[model samples]
Target chain A: MTEKDFELAGIRTVEEQPLRAKRKWYKEYPVVSMLFLGIMIVECFFCEQIMTVNPTYMDLEHCNVAPGRKFLFGTDTLGRDIFSMIWYGGRVSLLIGFVATAISTAIGVLFGAVSGVASPRADAFLMRAVEIVLSIPNLLMIVLLQAVLGGAGVIGISIVIGITGWMSIAKVVRTEVRQIRNSEYVIASKCMGGSFWHILWRHFLPNFWPSIMFMVVMNVRTAIVAESTLSFMGIGLPLEIVSWGSMLALSQQALMTGSWWMILIPGCFLIVTLMCVTDIGNSLRRDSNQRQSNL
Target chain B: MSEILIDVQNVTHHFKLNRKTAICAVDQVSFQIKKGEILGLVGESGAGKSTLARCIMNLYQPTAGRILYKGIDTCDRRQFKEHKKMLQTKRQLIFQDSTSSINQRMKAVDIIAEPLRINHVHTPRGSARAEAEFQLHYVGMDAGCLDKYPPELSGGERQRIAIARALSMEPELLVADEPIASLDVSIQAQIINLFKHLQKEHGFTFLFISHDLAMVEYLCDRVGVMYQGRLVELAPTRDLFSNPQHPYTRTLLSAIPLPDPKRERNRRKGVYDAQKS
Candidate 1:
């Protein structure tokens, strides 16, 4: 601070410091998220590999059976264990949700970032395209396209859901990227001689990542709901594999016979998964928003 | 004889306030800053002081006229990107609000290291860290604050880090535009002192822009009074204070509150409304 102070300190220029040690996500969310995710993962592994009973395998002897030692959620009319059916049904639907979300997010983010950073004319054109895509009724379009493909596989259904789901995400990303592009820090970065790409990649991407994370979780939930609706129409997944939507469809008739477990079991799994995704998305949104406003 | 370090020949910048009209933010402003001298630009909030600073920093290419830095044409529109890259590190601007100017996601150390890293002054990670720490100390900040983000630190700390960042380039010229405006009144004096000390040590041409005339008199060698995007008057600090010329400058000088109530009551009554023009 002074000549005397400088003489005492013996330091001149400030140096670039390495990134600080960061805490793991699990450490940050040790109680609820950790326990919940831990249980989900173990269940996934148990259903996928460890469970001896095949979800699709039917036994006549087990027909009309209720919840007992052998079958935890009771058996359906064709006599498949309700527990195994729900597990496998949930597995396929969750996988569809995740894959669909990934595809949509990838397309959306790329388009948004490009539109956000591009020339005004390009941005307008791209945004118009987004609006056009959004104008088409999502479920009706997916149903029509799937009807054309007829007997399309899970991958095809996922692609269909993703194609319809990305317009909103693109709009969100575009707005955020444009806002960050105009931020004072980005201007400051330019003043310091940082290239456009460097500023976008280094500064804008990290700032926009939290929003993207939140969007992805929300999109996954949307995708799952969309998948179930299509499958409920008997146009989504193959009838050979059990999905929550197909289970619900099959239980429609069974509901008349007073077999409530057929409808209730798979329905519970779907509700829980959607709730968990929403909770995660909300928390991520809060975490990001908190950094800006909270002390 | 003092050599001219910076020369501005009627620099003007216009902004499109709306679709129909273009407002002149810097209306043909012309002034020279001498080598190793602290030249202060004093004005009200919208008097275009910040615009003039940005023009000098070449952040905004002036609508007309040229700004020469050490005889190099800084506002040369020729070879656009090349000319900009050459002048960027040589001159730097420290903003008023570091919270908005700093990358909110970056650590204090990273913020300081940004200029150094980009300018290739320090390529290795270890040296960059050392340099950042040293700059923090230069700005009277402890190393413990280095790892914190801008949001995690106080306003003064963020400003210090911002200053440290600009200082890391070892700039030939520093245009600090109301750098202490957002800071506390108590901290304002300390930061002004720090700038003064740094100017003395670094011997860089400094442009200290502020509305605080008393502060300008204390820290500036020469002061330029800007009103409505125009530099109405310029003179040595002592000369400007003792023998004020412009009516606006006189009004500004009269507006300064004296510590003694009697002296303040006896102060000249001059209300220079900037909106009149």
Candidate 2:
């Protein structure tokens, strides 16, 4: 505002001014990342409609075909349509990513909130438990758990990843809750007879949502990588399930036959999805920080 | 001779720094605030004025002694739990810094109605928002600012909102801890006048803590002078200002600057050595 504008207007008039110029949603958010994620979701949701050939249909005649007009992403050693596999596999990947992240984030938030509000001794015990869980290598635990359960499916692997992934998120939430618990506004709420749930809903959730979102996005990337790692080792979802990880499981044969498309195409899809999620998470964190600083 | 609304008895609060040492923020201070009376507490910075106010508000559990409000010992956990609703509703606190006191993300109306909504207090005006609007106008604030956040408003306006929130509960006892310290000099006078009007019109009891001696002298009925966490003198505002007893109180009185240039030039500053005392 200029000095002349201030001279003409009163303090109330100045305060009434809009904080910033309004922008369209596209302008406000990361457009490219949002578009990519939206497309991925829509494409994966209609995989059956979009695929011309079954993902598991093996043609013995055309084996190890390179990128050609007949096959969008070429053919694997099994002669399966790589394009169909990518779409079909995408559904499982996205579902597992989202479901696992949701489970882990929920568990983490619960633990963190409880630990934050718990008494000193209880808090200490909870934090120690989290630390112990975090100290163990998650992959080994998942493998052991998968064996104990006899076999693994989409839900099974998601649950395994979720249970093991919550420790770091719990630690982050604990730190955030502890910091916010002592803020004057929170104390004011408490003094006004606001209950714990009320405070958590009104104050805790809104304040720490951005950080948790970032963690959730990062965890999705971890989950996808973990699934791929397990599949490559021949321990993940059975051969019947055509996930991107399962598609990549034939990498050894593809490498020996010099059919690079088998490994490269699926790897590109995974990387692109991970990058899109990371970009979206970064934008969210930035937006929240800017809002706080503006205040 | 009036009924004592708040009786603070031998209250002492200390913060443990470590296993070996502790800092006594509030010494064995005792005082009684009568119904419909304004008790102003004045002291230098770090004199435990704010700490004492927090103790009275039940924000801090005093290490020793007790505080009684309406014949119920607030210090006792069971008694506090038994009278939780009444205690929470009837006693409201206004913090020193309005910036930190009100949630920055919440609108003015929400901040004001929070106490009412939390306690589920039915207002004559039908809704909590209506009561909040009434309280805002009661504190001399315009209703136009009701939807604005704390950051959008100026310091004085934020403080007004804080005061409005406190008054929304129709609190019998209002504790203001340096409420005007962060405001401009002009706004400070306006807030002080608003406080005076509220006390007179509502007959509300006040425990006003401030570093502004001139304001306390103008606003309070009884004034208590605290020196290093100990209230050295408790007397009527006029008596304490004119015929001060404690050396620290005299020194504190002399520290107030005069408006007249000649008088200010001739003023003799009083000094008291803490070591010798």
Candidate 3:
């Protein structure tokens, strides 16, 4: 086909794909995601009350129980119901995950757009600065941040993770913006004497939206997993805070004794929640890629 | 044709690809476009026609030399912004690739009226839409085209929208850079006819850039033939066509095929070859 036909086909695909994919997304994933999200949100608000057998009010009387009626998912070695800990643990893990991702994504977009649209000298300088930040190992720096902050609790850990995690998304946005700067629409806008912000809003951002969606979803996954990993390493959250990683940290010794509830319950929740997040992200990726290829 | 519309003198554009390398795209190009005259610039693909058009519009900064619009030095640092606004209102450019030049996200009406909106052409916002409708009609598009996006329109329709947009400003001078290059020959003819009609009706000054010598001959008052980065020769359209001076111009002109199959079949008698010239 001719280039015009190709472009015509491209515009059709771009226009049509989003509506169809959105329908598909809701049909296949939204209900399930809503269910998972509902459960998570419920846990966040009422973890204390829903735990029927409150985790703090340990029952030494029913110690070492397994998947029984009175204490569902069984009781831990200390007789705290494992079910309650899992729900409460998710509160901090999921919170840390989302909050950090948000902070990092905001930082990423600002720096990325700046780097992308800036002059060559400024772009080089900004990207080099990004490179320097990216060069440092993520986990190592988070550990250092934790130590330096002296157990700054959930808030501090989230801030630290957010600060460290923005580079990749920033780089992605920068590259996308640079590509956008060359497109005919941008050149046309420049010819029309559009200001920097006008071009960014009208041309760059609209075209960059799909990719940004994908990056945001992916970053959510990274931030959540990183928080969990930090908790497992025993350096992410404070000892007082209950998180999936903190539970895992406490379960290490119990693993040798074969009392796996402490480890098994929280780990399962982490895996399940992460799986749901990845599914949402995958759908977003497919949607964005479909639109991107059309362009 | 008495007063000069655009004065481009000794202009050069050197693009630095890297810190250590640069390429001169336009070298010491001097030209004048008189009021109510269409000055056609014809050249090979890399002959800097588009670059010259861009420089004249102040869309690009030449490495050296200056452009004057009604005697205001457009390249002057302090006056660049002042002149740019004047140029934007009184002069405009229509590009080769219609699809690329028009924003896909915008409706045809919005695209046509964007210049007016940016420059605040009308007092109230609603009147801009009216002006846009008027422009679309001016370019022979119906009122129904106002709501349609660029992606939904055909190439010819899109170019019409671009022309409408450029003409909406009611510019005294319009630089058309290969405006018909991307269209089919039939559509190219129609657009050319429209441009000629508009020019004659309004006495619009034009800087028409194209590789199509026949189209240039049909439309322009004077034609400048460029090869590489320099103007090889320039003359009135008839003189340049009938008594070509530059070997490059002869090479370009000789390539145009005769319309009649009988004559075209035997038209290859004394082809101008560049290497021998």
Candidate 4:
């Protein structure tokens, strides 16, 4: 066979084999996977409908209407559909959470890999800088940045959360990189005259994935919660954006009037989404630990 | 005498801790492995034999001096890369702890084919499985082992696999760094015999570094004695054992318990003094 043909044949043979054995937990608790998948699908479908509803659209004729045929979740204080507001608000929250976390993780992985794999002098300098950033309270840093940026909109909040969220991920990645740098395969690669980028891409990055995954899962929840807090404090997004926190903020006056639907519906959706995300994260964490112990 | 294949000259390696404390791991160590000859390096725990082997392999950059392959410096990256195929095809290493050295995640076939893959030897003719199977059989393993992971094998099996992997590279010089140190006593003999057999059959030179003097004497043509990172004596295996010149070498040899129980019992009284001889 030709060289290219042989290489292709060899690669195909190797790739055909399964990389890891299927874990017992996955088989036993198939519902967990289904639940996570179902939630994701529902969230995706619902989020689009949320933006379509005019959260500020008032219907004086339908004001204070209880659960009825037209509005399943009933009308809010503003005469808007509570269900529609939730779909839109959840879209914003989920978007902010995922996008911000992704950006931070990418930054963290790059910084951490470079710092951990570089020489001692570079390592010390980078680690000290990481330490300084980590020492700052996350919420305060976000708030300070948000204030300086002069807006509490989606873009501003995302930027603030993304920048500050990376510190924790960077620390985790740095620790993992330091440990993997000394592995035999890495040393072997060096002996084979492999370049630094080659070593980083081939060896360090693959091994760094499990931790990065864990960090992403954990950071999503943090970003979501931070965004909610900023929004609740009247500093995130425009007043028109119908977020859960904005709904809560709007409900404070209506709570005394016994219009409980204003707060309870959005609040429940937020709680459920957070809980499901946390469950998935916890499962991933358990899987990671099991894999490590097996190793 | 066979032509000199590897010349390690005045190589000194020190592990520096801050400015004040520096531990000299290999101090001006020098040796040569002739083509198609087995040269054993025997020493105690802190003897720097492994460090010397690592320096020769260019895994650890030496603090001073040179390691030459066919009289050309092996330390230059450009020269090393230019002769990459020669280096990968001509030199291989068998580590002390075979299980730890081989990537546990990789299958037996992949582990054996690693050097070939890295050196791009199998690129043009990528029959890694065929080559791997051949080497595995050479070391008494079958194609069935190709699918197995490192953790699935016994210590002896792992070492055998390690040896097969090293030999598969078609190395002219094999650095067996305490290849049997982690194996059982019964298994050690089998591995030692395998090394000897492979050397004879393949006509490959060997630099066997080990703490076991007896094993070294049994397998090597020439033996070198190392103490505190320095080679104090070098000669033919039998000659070095019978007429050791260095005090450390004499102490080391004298401390080896004789096989006979009666001789061992009688020598027990002088054993400690022998260790200090």
Q: What DockQ, on C-alphas, does every prediction get?
A: 0.45, 0.49, 0.30, 0.15
The candidate with the higher TM-score, 2 or 4, is 2
Per-candidate iRMSD = 1.2, 1.0, 1.7, 2.7
Q: Which candidate number would show the highest DockQ if scored against the true structure?
A: 2
Highest-scoring model, lDDT: 2
The lDDT values for all models are 0.84, 0.89, 0.83, 0.79
lDDT (10s digit) by residue, model 4, range A74-141: 78766887777777777778888888888898888889888888799999999899989898988788
lDDT of 3 by residue, A215-235 (tens): 687777787788888877777
C-alpha lDDT of residue A281 in model 1: 82
Q: Please, what are the lDDT tens digits per residue for candidate 1 over residues B1-277?
A: 2999899999999998899999988998888888899999998878999988888877788999888887777787674455676688878888988788898889988888988767677543359999899889999999999899888898888888889988888888898988998999888988999999999899999999998888899999999999889999999999999999988998988888999999888887799876774
lDDT of 1 by residue, A1-295 (tens): 6666656465666798988879775655424643665566467656867454888888888886777888888888888887887767777787788889989988887788889988999999999999987888888889887888777777888888887788877888889899988777777778889976677677877877877788888998999898888778778886677878878877776777788888888788788777777877888888778765764
RMSD of each: 11.1, 6.8, 8.2, 12.3
TM-score of model 4 (first chain only): 0.81
Give the lDDT of residue A223 in candidate 1: 90
Candidates ranked by DockQ: 2, 1, 3, 4
Pull out the clashing pairs in model 2.
Answer: none
Cα lDDT tens digits for candidate 2, A119-157:
889999999999998888999987987788868899998
Q: Considering only chain B, report the TM-score of model 1.
A: 0.94
Candidate 2: chain B TM-score equals: 0.98
**Cα deviation of B220 in candidate 3 (Å)?**
3.2
